[model samples]
Structure formats: structure tokens, C-alpha cells
Target chain A: MKKLVNNPVNVVEEMVEGYVRAHPDYIKQLQSNDRALVNARETKENKVGILIGGGSGHEPGFLGYVGEGMADGVAVGNIFASPSPDPILEVTKAIDKGAGVVYLYGNYAGDVMNFGMAAEMADLEEDIKVGMALATDDVASAPKEEKDKRRGIAGEFFIYKAAGAAADFGYDLEEVVRIAKKANQNTRSMGVGTSPCYLPQTGEPSFEIGDNEMEIGLGHHGEPGIEKGPLETADKIADRLVNDILADIEITKGEEVAVLVNGLGSTPKMDLYIVYRRVEQILSERGIKIYRSYVGDYITSLEMGGCSVTLMKLDKELTDTIDHPVNCPMFVQK
Target chain B: MKKLVNNPVNVVEEMVEGYVRAHPDYIKQLQSNDRALVNARETKENKVGILIGGGSGHEPGFLGYVGEGMADGVAVGNIFASPSPDPILEVTKAIDKGAGVVYLYGNYAGDVMNFGMAAEMADLEEDIKVGMALATDDVASAPKEEKDKRRGIAGEFFIYKAAGAAADFGYDLEEVVRIAKKANQNTRSMGVGTSPCYLPQTGEPSFEIGDNEMEIGLGHHGEPGIEKGPLETADKIADRLVNDILADIEITKGEEVAVLVNGLGSTPKMDLYIVYRRVEQILSERGIKIYRSYVGDYITSLEMGGCSVTLMKLDKELTDTIDHPVNCPMFVQK
Candidate 1:
């Protein structure tokens, strides 16, 4: 394995430690619970808190978004494993103000179970009202009718942005949840994987594919994608990803969207741009207007070689939210 | 090759087209010279235009740095190759506003020859004054006395930051060149490679290494590094890189620095963070302060597996310049 790490067992600890050390201006580890990385600056009183977290490995995903106007707190787990209820409760309590808190994360079985347990713990122990908006935007995971059951992909970036902006915009907890849910519902993502990421601890591949094959809907945790096929051109893959998303979202002519061509892990940013170019072409041909574009590794699966194309249908509010000023560690939007 | 691109010959063109479309607010493709991506918003009159460019493949390296308060324009080239004098001249003419323009790019023989030719062309044809600053921060490439012969690695991020900020801060082309040169001199970087990146066009590896072996101080373009050794732990490797940098530059106690732990391409950000943790430990132990930090893929070598650690020694002026607000498409500092 080409993974550069120390002991695999201590990967999360060192990662979180280094992350806090790297961006002390924006984030700090929770005093009691080391797993939680909260905003260094104090969250405004009576403003709803925006907490986003998930399993580790996908760096800058859950933790990179933590800042004053972005994710208020992050509860980090071990590699591809959810944080226990304890650290989640700690972050929830730390970020909570009189207005309560909202939890937004990718929709995965481990996350759903763990975050739900933490919400219950927070409610029972501290009387904190918590709202949740699980991002279920991966279109390749399930049929359109079963969108609710789909795993959240890179669309979590949009969900986190909207939720964070809404929270900072002084919206109440319920409204923040609504906005987060709306963003998740409107966003669609599909990923194609050319190579698998190895587990740092075990040095084991997440999944395997033939040297010249790729899987269209492979999940971040090496979960099954739609199908594995022979490697194709960037334009062809972009066409396939865009078609899959457009078919599920039903974006009308002249409507606007925020296009995010995200590299899974090892896919080069140059290729992502090439893919974004194709996505833009297909959208323009279909009369869909692109409001903004983000191309990079917003979320990744360790060293997995692949990419995902996500489109978040935008309205006036979502547009404003996307344009909202942000100072996150991973993403800085002015 | 796991590259997601069409005909390798057109990678640069498609990349430039896609880049301009993705960031119309910050950059636009030049009409007369498609290779140049200049500021979308009209540059302020009399402001020293800061133009940065080199080869493609390193996404967000030269092209990503273009914006109003950052790089004024960029001249893109094919993968791992320098832009011709024609496009460079066009960018110089377009960005020139009587105060002249300054060109800052990595120090490469091809780039030096091409950009030097462009400077002469601009002087003879357009009568526009041009200043130049070559980034030479790759400490592994040369000895201290031969620093001028060193290759510019990820340290270009800081060099561009200083030059762009200095130019936009109303400094003349000469002053911008001076500041950029100072940044380049003060910055030092070392990189390690575990796996080589395969060129999309040729589907050939940049270099080869045994599966259990790694190279220290490897150049991004596959130049030889220090030595081949058994794959070492992240901590041991970080120690070697930091030691080499510190030994070369006398950053004494209480002097602050801006640390950049960058991914070459395919190295996981999680691993970078782990590496950063070790780097921070070493710095803390030595009483060398880390003023600010950037931990991600700022400049990349396509899908090469490994990372580089860059440290830019900071003074008050460099500190302010580094923190100066930026709005580039690839980098945003607020």
C-alpha cells in the first residue's frame, strides 16, 4: 500500500490532532471528547448550530467544513466507522445554543445509527432539541422512487453549505433542517471508480476492479456501485454520470444549478476539470444554466481513483446560500 | 492508465476551456490567444499585473491562481511543458496597464527559455515592460549555493500569494518582483514518492519504484530524489523531510513560518494530515512556530502517489501578504 501513515490504529487520532494543529484559527478539539472538533470561535447565542460529521478517511469532508460560518462542530470516527454516541453528544452540547442544533451528514448505515443514538443521548441527558437532515442524493445507489434510501455522496457539500449558511443566517433549527433537507433533496450525485482505496490500517484494498475496468456507482466506503464496465473516455464517463443525474433530477430548461465535479481520491484535479467541461456542455445543450462550479476533492475515499459529478438544483435561496460567505478550513468562499 | 481524459493531445485545450467556463467570474479565455486565461473583471488601471503560468497537469497551480486580487492572468501549456512565447506575450500585453506586468513561475529550463523569449517579444513588439521572478524552492533539487538551480515545487503557492498580493497592493512591477523573489528564497520544500504518475497521453509512468521502496526528495516531474529506501513510517519520513528543510534554512527559535503540507496527487489528504501531525511535533519541539498552515493539494502532479512539505519562513510583510484576502478560483483566502 502506498498509504503514508503511522500505526493504522492511531490514524484518526493523529489526523484529528494534526488537523487541529494545522487550522487552530478555525477549529479546536473538544476539551473533554477528543473526537469532536468544534469551531475555535464561539458560536453566536440563539443561533442554530450546524454539526456535520461522519467516518474518517474522507478528509476535508466532515472536518474541513468546520468553522465560524460552516460546520459548527464535527464528530470524527475511525476509518469508515461512525463516531460513538459519546463524542457526538459532546459536540452537540458544545455547539448548541438556546436555539438548539441540527445534524447533517451523508446517509450511511453506520452514520444513521450512530448519529441517531447521539441525538437521543443529547435529548435525554441535556434537554437539547436536535434536528437531522441526512443527505440522500446519490442517484446511482437506488432508483429515483427510492431516493430516500440512497446513500449520500458528494452532495453533502451542498447540504452542509446550505445548512451552515441557514444557521448563520439566524434561521431557527427547524428552518435550518428544512433548508438542509431541501438542498439534499434537490441535489443528485453519481460516482465512477477506476481504482480502490486501501485501508491504512490493514493495507487492504477497499474493493477491486480489473486494471481496465470501472464501477459507475461505487460508494465512498467501497460499497457497490451500479455496475463495473471497461474503462471509457473521460467524455464518455462524464456523459454517463451527467445522464444518470439528469435523469433522476428532472432539471427543467433554463433552470440553474451548482455543479460540483469532485475527485474521489486519486483522480487528478485536471481530469475533474475535463469532466466538468463535459458536464457543462451537456447542461448547456439541455438549456440548464450553471450557477457556479466546484471542481476538486471536496470529499474523497482515501486513495480511491475515481470521481463523482453532483448537481444541486438552485433557487433564489439556494443560490444565495451557495454564494454565502464562508471561511471553512477546507473551503473558503468569499 | 486510470486517467479520465479523452485524446491526450487535447488535454490542455479541453482543460483550459473547462477552466474558463467553471470560473467566468475570475477568468476568461483570451480571444486572440486561447492559451491565456486572463482576469474576467477588468484589471484596475496602473496596477502591476501578476501573470503566473507553466505546464498543465498541475491543476490549480498556475491556472487556478488567476483572479482579481491574485494572479491577473495565466498562460497555460501542455502537460509538463512550458507555454510558448506567443501566449505569454499575449498575456503580458493584455495585463499591461502602464505600470508593467511581472511574470512568476516555477524555475524550469523550458519555462525559463519560453518566458524569457516572451519577455523579449513583449519588449520589442508591444513596448511593455516586464519583470520576472523564478520560484526556486525545491531544496532537494540543489545545494544551498546552487539554490538558483533548484526546481520550484509546491512553494509556488506562497510565491504567487506574495507576488499577487504585492502587485495588487499597488507595488510597481519591480517591487512585486522583489517580494516574489524574497518569498521564493525563504521557502524550502522536499517531496517523497511512493508511486509514479502515468502520463495520460503516453500511459507511461513518470518513474518506477519497487512496491516496497520509496524515494525521498523526488521531483514532481519524476526527477531523482535523495535515495531509495524501504518504505518508512510517516513519522520517520516527515522527520527526514523537515530535517532537510531546517538544515538548509536557518529558521531559528521564535521565528514563525507558514507550513504547507501538500499532496503530490494521489496521496490521501488523511495521510497528509498524519504527516502534518508529525511535522507539527517536530516544529513544536524545536520552538519553531507555525504561523499559518495549508494542508491539502495546492499544487499537484496528476496522480502521483506521495506528498511534499513546504515551509515559508515568514516576517511581518510576508505574513500580511500570505493572509491578504484572495479570490482565485483555485485558492480563496478571506
Candidate 2:
């Protein structure tokens, strides 16, 4: 109830309206479906469309990436709830270039079911070829042996960056899907939550956390984590997250990778860098080269206090794509 | 306190160490003084040095801007306290390329005193020319007739951008100071705090408010604002802030201005955009044209829940400079 929203029921719509208003030249609501957002500048002719969609509350994730160099469109759902087939289809239609459209989203059960249905419906009724690429980069969500079963976390940012660059480069839908999958496979993330976030509809937190405890591996939508334990120092927390991510990857001592330290909602950027300090130390000691590093709230749960560390074990292609220039409202890297 | 720090007493130094670790390619600790941060890449020969410094709690504010297209160096201070004269002098010495150095920071007493003393000392002892440019853009901090008495808020971002661009373009010290002053003169801002942020050392909020109330015009470091009242709708809060800023500036019809809707620490990015929605609408209705808009956490108190609106009435020079590409770790516009 402490949130700075109008009516709780109207948070999503207002957020969408405000976002488009704030970035008037960059994004707009789909004429056919207000829940679907598309870049104001139309997708280039004959280029593969890059569409990313997911539940709301993760600002700058699915919607904020809609721009010239990133996602062409996004279908927004209610808070932490998947978009229905309607919005997804609308977005697919809005951003579909002659080459077809590719769908990129987090690997949550609800999202997978919804986006999958949308893709099927688009192909059957609308004659649009929709390719699907799910992000499965959260190392703690599943054992390494079951990597495909892991839910996506902060690594979704890297996937979107790489895939968007590929699509913008005029890659075919299959090629775009390949790069998306490759990016996801090369990425791994793990986080520890020190606070809980409330669902706006219920105005209550889905789970309880102690004043001095931390929830390791909690999902963006309050999913279960490894365990709740007494809060530890920044160095120890960084060790835990970095170790979890390294265990799930095949990074060699001399390999180069991109490091991302992401803050979940209320964690200060200052603290994220503190965590990044340890991440850098461990990687350096292990002889791993950090090709580039990003530290910020790239993706977030609404006001949930914690941080996630993501590493993309990069190949030349992935690194090139990540270094590709982007001009989105939330993130613009040159 | 639920902060992810090693020791509260060591927060500033650790943060400095961590920031350099996180962005080793963009910034480094000064060899003369660890508290001073200099751009890893040296400034172009003879370009006027742009040195920004302030209290430590405002991450990304005074330090994050130190890079190729922004500040040349920064002096880091203890949490919520001005950096001592030593670090300021060290930073000035590190970045001075023989042209001159300019100081850009918020209008705070401690910072003003310390920086002014450093400037004096540098001129007399080190023979370095240092110029001062204060940011006074917070409308709520003082009445329109007493605008110079106001404190600086998020408007400091625009000041830095304009002044940094001027300096980077090889403007003389006087021209850089002129641009910085003009940007400050044309800027206006107001904010509302929904929750208080604690000082890490004290582990207590500097102030308090009821759960249902908010502090209008609250300063970044918990300074007193216009009033404390019941928390209003996002639209109402935006209207209040916008009206206050407009009342203090001569923003006529057909004039272009850049708008910044900044979140103070714990305010979710979603709420910030919701507020921006109304800010844009109000500006449109008043016939004021928006040249560009930025909505994010630019200047923040550590985990304080609030949002501030800033307007920088723009001219062709300011607009061109704003659009100029700058590569900084936290902010990049291309």
C-alpha cells in the first residue's frame, strides 16, 4: 500500500501510458492492442522482427528494450502475470517484417505457455511465422544437468542484447533464434534477495523474510530459492552468487566473459558495485578475463531488495553483438 | 540496517574501491590520494578539466560521470559529508592538463566550503587555476525571488552534461563556466519523499513521516521541504512538482526544454514513469515543448523513496550538446 500508484488495478495501464509518454519519440502503444508496445520508428523492411514480451513490474526489461537496435515490440501483461495470446498476437502482427518475427522472453511456466499459444495461434490463423526463444540462464533454478529447466533471470538482458543485434543485422528468423539460444546458453545468473516484493493486486508480499536473513536464488516473481540464511557480508554474498554461476558454466581459466551485477529493486547501485568488487576479484584470481562489465538495475522486481550477478561466457559473435550500439530509452550504449 | 556493506565506517573507501573495480576501464583511484577518482583515459591535451565532487551517498552522481565525455575527475567523500580539501586538490592536480579545472557540484554548504578552500589552495600553492560553478535549481528549496538560495537536486545532471560537453569541446575555462551557469540558471526541480533514508553510520533515518504521508520538496540528504502531507496520487504528486518548478521558471510557449523525472533511491522505476506521464501532459497542455526527456534514478539519496522533476529550458547550443554522444559507465546517449 506504500507504493506511489493510483488505483492498484490501474498500475499496469498507467505505467504503459507513462512510459510511452516519457519516450514519445521512441515507443508507442500498438493501435490494435494497447498492451502491446512497438517502436515508433517502424522495423526495417524485410528484416526479422525482434519481439520480447513478459509480465509487468520488470520495467526496462521487456518494454524498455523496444528501440531501433533492440526489441521491435513488446507485449505487456499484468504484474508478474503472463500476457494473453491476444496481446502477443497483436505485437507479432505489429512488428512482423516480411522475414517474420522472433519471440524472446524469460523461461517462466506462465510465460512459456502463453507465448507458445500466441506463436501457434499466429501461425495457424494469421499466417505469421513466429519463432520462440526462451531464456534459461538462472543457474539456481535447476541443477546443471537440467539446464534447460532453469528459469531465466538477469541474463535475459544479455540474451536480448545479443539477439536484438543479430536481428537488426538482418539475420533470418532461424539465425536470430540460433543466436538467442546461443546467448542464453552462454549466460548464467544467480541472486540473493534480502526483502520481499508485494503483488499489487493483493497488496501483500507472497513470502516473508527475516530482518537479518537473505533468500538465495529467489526469482523475480518471488519464486523459491536455495535456502534462507543469516545475512552475510558483501564479499561472502558475492562469493555465493559467483560460485553458483561458475558451477553451471564451462568457463575456462583463460576465457573472456562479460560480467553484469544487477540490483533487484531496492538494492542501491553503490552496493551492487560492492558485490561487483568481489566478483571481479574472484574472476581475476581464477585468470578469467572480464571483456566488459555492467552493474545496475537492468532488470528488477518491484522494490525487492537484493542483487544478481550474471556472466555471459562469450564467443566472438556474442561479444560483437553485445558491443553493438544500442539506442533504447533505458539503456543506450555506444 | 539491511545494507550490503562490510563495515559502515569503511563504506566510502570500500565504495570507491568497488567502483574502480567495477569500472576499471573508465575510472581509477588517484595515486596521490585514494579518495580522488580520475578518468582512466586521460583528458585530451589542453582541454579544461571538469572536476565534480560531493558527499559519498550520491552514487553515480559525482563519480559515475567521470569518463571521456563527462567529468575528468572526482573527489569522493564520506557518506553525506563533503570531501576534505586534500582529495579535491589531488583530483584537481590529476586532471589539470594546463588549461584549468572547473568544479561542478550541488549547492551544499560543506561541499561549497571544502571546494572553495581547495580552489584557493590550488591557486596559491599548486599554481592551478580552478573555477567554481554552483548548481541552484531546486525550486522548492527557496522562493522564486530567492532562487539563488535554493539547493541543487537532479538538475545537476544537465549542468554537468552541458558544462562537460563545453569543456570536452575545448572551450576555455570562462566559456565552460558560462555554460555551466546558464544551464543552472535555466534549470528547475522539485521532489517528494515517501520514505526516509538512513545514514549508514547512525543506522537511523534522518527524519520520519507517517506511512500515509510524504514530504514535498525534500532535499536529497533529508533537508526540510515545503510541507508534509498525505501521500497523493502519482498524477497529483507530479502536478505539484511540475507546478512548483514552472512557478520558478519563465518557460514560455513554443520554447523547448529537456525534462528529467528522477527517482530518489527506493522509488520503483515504474512509479517514476507513472509520474512522468502527468509531467509530460502538464507541459503539453501549457504549450511548453519538450526537446528531450530522461526518466530514471539520476541523483539519489541512499535508498530513500521519492521522485524529483527537473526542467532544463534548452537553446540550440544546449540541445546540440545534450545530443552529443558521451560514453560514461552509468549514462550513455548516442
Evaluated with DockQ, which candidate comes out highest? 1
What range of 10 consecutive residues in model 1 chain A has the weakest lDDT sum? A60-69
DockQ, structure candidate 1: 0.86
For model 2, name the residue pairs that clash.
none
The local lDDT score (0 to 100) that residue B215 gets in candidate 2 is 92
True contacts kept of 2: 0.64
lDDT of 1 at B67: 85
- lDDT, candidate 2, B1-334, per-residue tens: 5888777788888778878987788989988899999989987789999999898777778788888778999998888888999999999988889999999988889989999999999999999999889999999888888878889889999999998999978899999999999999999999899888878788999678897899998999999988999989989998899998887788999999999999888888888888888999999999999888899889889898989999999999898778867888888877
Runs in model 2 with CA error above 4 Å? Answer: none
Tell me the lDDT of model 1 at A293.
Answer: 95
Query: How high is the TM-score of chain A in model 2?
Result: 0.98
Cα lDDT tens digits, model 2, A248-296, are 7879999999999998888888788888888999999999999999998
Model 1, range B237-271, lDDT digits (tens) per residue? Answer: 99999999999999999999999999989998889
